[model samples]
Target chain A: METKNDGPKQEQRLTKKGKETRARIVAAAAKLMFERGVAGTTVEDVQREAKVSASQLYHYFQEKRELVHAVILFQTAQVLSAQEPLLSHLDSIDALWSWRDAIVSLQVERQCRGGCPIGSLASELADSEPVARAELASGFMKWELAIRGGLIAMHERGQLRGDAEPERLALALLTALQGGLLLTQVHRETSPLEVVLDAMLAHIGSFAQS
Target chain B: METKNDGPKQEQRLTKKGKETRARIVAAAAKLMFERGVAGTTVEDVQREAKVSASQLYHYFQEKRELVHAVILFQTAQVLSAQEPLLSHLDSIDALWSWRDAIVSLQVERQCRGGCPIGSLASELADSEPVARAELASGFMKWELAIRGGLIAMHERGQLRGDAEPERLALALLTALQGGLLLTQVHRETSPLEVVLDAMLAHIGSFAQS
Candidate 1:
């Protein structure tokens, strides 16, 4: 139920070219943070990777914390957008399985390298960075809502049992995905992701109308 | 499937007093790393926290990577030992629910503040540190096996359907747990963890013997 109201708001004032420069910095920072984590990725490193001078980087982000906020927004948008229409219409068991397949395939493609971008941020900042934690929380809320949309549609169509709670079910699916990705990333294998998603989808199937 | 053969091996040669000093250093390092993350916690912080001189700290650990490996082992042992007999005896639905309750209660007691100790380390180190990743993967494998022990016992007793694979089920439970804890930590609530565990347990119950 946590809402996302606060994000890096400097973009509204930037010209088109300025926006591009800012976004390029965020992209580089995201990639580095995803690989090395927040504490390991420094402002100087972001500057080096983004090919921007100290003045240019500081013009957009006053500190690494601000840059981190931008990265959270960037990664959240990327992850949610990647799911696209599939996440919006999880109305059937088959549709859910398709979503599962898409997730597993992506992890397999990456050879289980980086864990969930938002999740990695959450793990690193949840204890120390209150602002980052809120932003990440909002990102998860948005994701949970996207997932809930599908289950809500299924429930409305009477494809699911009366006891099936769409909100809870959607949250469970997202939770499984996070855990699966973490395990898969550590094990450098796809089975953890595959197994957890399959288990969640199977749980959903158990609620199907018969 | 990962094995835990490699841990900080310096303890084997230490006398009782040496072992205590080494353990004190690891405990301090684990506490700092748990709060500030692996990259954020430096050797100086650990030495200061443990009240040890630099020479003494160097005598025990050659570098921070060795210290991290020690922290991983310490956390893994702490987590598994805390689970105790419950993790060893998750043979029935009621027993599983009890285990779930214990986990939730601990999270709530902590006010949902530090995410799983092992999970936080895995998130920060899994990608950057291969040795630490293997240590974490081994920890998860051991935890999975403990959960599997109960499920396998139930399966052999015909308490579950023939189709139920204990290994997969145990992995699912642990996966759900990691995801739920991550969400709960970010949102500072207990529902995500509660819902995921309940869903997974319900899924397990669906395989109950008629």
Candidate 2:
């Protein structure tokens, strides 16, 4: 659990308008990277999409790697925020199922076009970019902890079996999710996501107090 | 379940030497793609690594997409074949655990450098290349069928509970593996794969007959 404070330090020095410009640039980069991938999207593409000049983009991000790091943090927050109250309150089996339904429905609505934003980043940059990989790993750790929080609450409440390990269960659920999304994205169908999440939830349910 | 006859038809017409040359080019492409990614590796890189003339490379693969398709098939076969009799015979829980050990050990031996070859490809190319996505999906389907074959055998033999669905269980196992591998690759550790797979096996074990 090594925590690295890799957030862009330059953001602290920016004025209100400068911070707005930086946020806009990161959002533009995130969108393009989501659609065209990190390698496929260029600095020029971000500049053009954000309506910012090269100097402005560079001022916010020293290079593409810095921008990609910003995008990872942006996506991490975006994804977890989107999961919201559901992710924060997985203390019961019913709540977990509801969370699963929310996730699957969102994928179906999007037609499974983009897999997990953090996951796609991990797949592409894990090996080649060590710094980015660490950031992505940290992002996943945060996600796992969020899932673990609910399971731990259930365990503490005596809702889960005494032998049930919340940390392991949380990791399993996240793994199933990442795998399901990958398959769903590849097949362009929601069945894989549905099947995997259902399976994980069923496994979690098995530990519920009868 | 639409099967596309997308294999290079011209490969069938090649002489032994021509086929060897084609394979050499493909093996090189697969290596580069695995190491550098589909976008990072260029046709020229493959030509240089394979030590084949551009004309000969083109003779086998008319485009990068075709080459990526070949790599998908290559890695699929390579991965599945490496699993051997274990993948083909998952009749009992012991057998299944043994298969899990084999997979986990391989990841450890490789230091988890390359995630799943087919998985990484699917992550990178699934959305961008529809044809490759279909082929990668087919590869996953084949892998799933192999896993299902064992569970189905167990069900037929009364080793599993009557309510256990082999297809769903198999897909769940695959999903866990894919997710585990992705996380393990990002973290550069085998614990994620081990934890997720162990949870999946525990779930499957719940259906085991006494």
Candidate 3:
């Protein structure tokens, strides 16, 4: 059932050089898309940036859509890995505060230039590109699940109330985070994110088992 | 103050025909941008879609960036005017619930296709396009102000506690709304938005003067 268009699947069977070239192309595309948006980045631009020949680029991604899909997954991993240390320590409120601080500080350090990388991709592709849309949704789900797991751990430790719904609360926290990033991304300031995280954390604090 | 490159200021002095043509171009651009995004859209596509001659297009918007700015304003107005009626009734907690219902209903009606039109634009242009970024930020500010004004009204009526901090609460509410819309847009479901709004409203209810 393999067709000529099954370039992506066959790409997985590449040699180490081919795999490295593929990864390099994806990394270049991700950086370009982050700066210029999915619509702005072109296959030619990726080829030039990644220093891959057009044939080599096509060997990895048969189409631009396929490349974008790979970029979404790449960004999802990049965003999550950066937060892994904080994510693993979220059993305590102090850990949550630390996590929030890390996020804000990262924004500040980047001069609030780029919002959440995964969020930017999601916003651009969600409506127009169906495949990328699903992948982005899955990315958000993974992010929310990570946050929810931490909340559930806190509930198990009796830090949160018995009635606190971990799933809903985690969704809310993730939403606040996205909203804050959207505002901060536009304003090029950390105030919106700070205000959002603080308010959301206060709401979470209210549910503590006193 | 009359510079040669003052394309926008001169546009304000248009005749009836000129105004209509300008509006037509903006509306067409907005529609295309909504579907294809700013990067994917071009002057040629807009000219064809708007049915304006090349000279006419340049007469209105000297460049694509100028057209994008107009589209941003168009979307801002489109988003705000739809909620104007509900926004005016935020004097009571019931009004807030009604507003929330209206938003959810609107999303359901659209099958959760587009997130906030303004939000989508913000995510794409915030970093790459400075003027558009500022315009998008202003749009969010206007939206936040409307919400903050409502909360302030409630606080003034003693419906909310004296320490409710309407500004922060409004920002938080706005954040939650944006986050919910982002998730909903990608998932093509109303549940993410529904859950976020409900949880945010519950938090607001906690500040009610009982």
In angstroms, give how far residue B130 of model 3 lies from its true place: 1.1
Candidate 1, TM-score of its B chain:
0.96
Q: For candidate 1, write residues A141-160 as lDDT tens digits.
A: 89999999889999989999
Ranking by lDDT: 1, 2, 3
By TM-score, is 2 or 3 better?
Answer: 2
lDDT of 2 by residue, A12-128 (tens): 788999999999999999999988889899999999999999998888788899889889999999999999989988889999999999998999999998999999999999999
- DockQ, prediction 1: 0.89
- Docking quality of model 2: it rates as high
lDDT of 3 by residue, B82-112 (tens): 9979886676778999999999999999989
Native-to-model Cα distance after best TM-score fit, residue B39 in candidate 1, in Å: 0.4
Q: After TM-score superposition, what is the CA distance of residue B158 in candidate 2 from its true location, in Å?
A: 1.1
lDDT of 1 by residue, B1-210 (tens): 233433435577889999999999999999999999988999999999999999999998889998898888899999999887788889998899999999999999999999899999999989888888988998898999999999999999999999998899999899999999999999999999999999999999989895
* Residue runs of model 2 more than 4 Å from their true location after superposition: A1-8, B1-8
lDDT (10s digit) by residue, model 2, range B23-94: 998899999999888988999999999999999888788898888888988899998999998999988999
Pairs in clash, predicted candidate 3: none
TM-score, candidate 3, is: 0.93
Q: How does candidate 2 score on lDDT? A: 0.90
How well docked is model 2, in DockQ terms?
0.81
